[model samples]
Target: MSLARRASAEFAGTALLVAAVVGSGIAAARLSPGDVGLQLLENAFATALALGALILMFGPVSGAHLNPVVSAADWWLGRRAGAGLTVRELAAYAAAQVAGAVTGTVLADLMYGLPAVSWSHTDRIGGNLWLAEVVATAGLVVLVFALARSNRATATPAAVGAYIGAAYWFTSSTSFANPAVTIGRAFTDTFAGIAPASVPGFVAAQLVGGVLAVAALAAWYPQAGRSADAVVVPHLTEETALR
Candidate 1:
């Protein structure tokens, strides 16, 4: 696919992913007032379902990354092998993903009759939360690349969705493993939103986790770079393959 088409797919995918997250949180809060556990369950289920569906919908076009860390990992792991995105493509994908995330948050808020930019005040800072972010993000990176390396790329949509859903319950930070999503969630003060002040710590933790995961993958699967083209899902065309 052309860079324009791939970047467009990333934008749309990330937008809908955030919408699922924030919108579901809003609906869950309204639907199950005062029951935090049930609300979280509702939000997790919706997000998982939406994530799987969105990956299936956009994977063939753009790999459905929907996250900056995923895109960066793809580029980093595949650079030597020339199998994944170039530096230029990574920058474009990250920009598009972040923009889409913000747009998605706005859309979700508007759908719920809320302000477009409420600015979340849910302070989610702490050593435990930061540890959770690291664990969540590292696990995500490992799962994504490991599947690609093991020739299970076709199962990514379902597996990734399941892992994230599970992580929501296990992780203290509710697994906002994606930096773009973290930034987007700052735009809303709803259930899924993280305070803008908390974004930096979460993002830093996520990046650290990603780097650690990549190092582990490099050690375990020295040849993993060969499969980086299929991270998330194979979206490369014959034309791009030749490039």
Candidate 2:
């Protein structure tokens, strides 16, 4: 596929993923008023199902990364083998992912009759939350790459969705494992929003988690790079084939 087409897919896929997350949170809060636990359950369930569907919908087009860290990991781990995205493609993908994320947030807000760009006021900073982000992000990275390496890519949609749903309850940060999504969530003050001030910490912690995951994968799957082209999902192009 052309880079433009692939990047477009990334943009749309990431946008819809964020919409699912932020929109579902809004719906959950309204539907289960005064019940934080129930609201969370509703939000997590919706987001999980949306994620799996989005992946299935766009994976063949752009690998449906929908996350900056996932794209970065695919690039870093596959660089040596020349199997994943090139540096230029990585840059494009990240840009699209972040932009799409913010757009998604706005879309969700508009859908709920809220301000399109309401800055989030929710404070979500703390040691525990940061640690949770690390754990959640690391696990995501591990799961994504491991499945690709082990030739179980087909299971990623269901497996990843199930993992995130579970992590919502298990992690203190509610598992905002994607940097793009985190930044996007800051645009809304609804149930899923994070204060703009808190975005840096969450993003930084996520990056750290991604780095740690990469190191662990190196040790556990030394030859994992050979399968980097298939991370998240397989979408081979003539360009990658030539590489």
Candidate 3:
């Protein structure tokens, strides 16, 4: 795919993810204010399900990164192929994701009367919040690497989605799997934003998680080192065999 096409896919996928998160937050706010915990649970489940489906739907066309962190992870894995994105591509994709997420939050706020800041439980700040981000992102990266390395995984996308969905529920941080999404959600002051003060910690945690996942993958698949590059994201080309 051309750069424009890839960017477009990233934009669309990010839009869908943000829409789901914002929409779920709105629904949760209205459906069970007293059961806030349950509301979060529902949101996480929905987010995971949506993410998995989207990856399956878009992975073939544009690799379905939808997150700057994922793109970075792919680069680190040495999977940038002839189609690897440049800094410009990364910036554009990240910008689109943040923009789409902000739009979704604004729309949800208008429709559901979500508080601009205090009322929206969307803020993602605090030590606990940072921990959550780390764990959630770790699971995401680990899963992607594992699936990309194996023939069985490459043959099907459902497992990828299933793993993500499960991790959201299992992880302490309801899984803000995308850094761009996390930053964009912060702007809404809704149930999604991690406190800006806490953003750095969360991001740091995520980076650590990513590194650990990469290390683990390296140990499991010795052949992966054959490529000189560090990151090894999945790629598409007619000439290359699936395995």
Cα-based TM-score, every candidate: 0.97, 0.98, 0.78
Model 3 TM-score is 0.78
Q: Any idea what lDDT model 2 has?
A: 0.93
Local accuracy of candidate 3 as per-residue lDDT tens digits, 17-105? 77677778768766878787888877777776787777776666567777777666565565434434456666766676667666656
Ranking by TM-score: 2, 1, 3
Which residue segments of model 3 deviate by more than 4 Å?
A: 79-92, 110-128, 154-157, 224-243
Per-candidate RMSD vs. true structure? Answer: 1.2, 1.2, 4.3
Q: Model 2 TM-score?
A: 0.98
lDDT of 3 at 228: 15
Clashes of 2: 0
Cα lDDT for residue 234, candidate 3: 50
Give the count of colliding residue pairs in each prediction. Answer: 0, 0, 24
| lDDT for each candidate structure | 0.93, 0.93, 0.63
Writing each residue's lDDT as its tens digit, candidate 1 over 123-161 gives 999999999999999999999999999999999999999
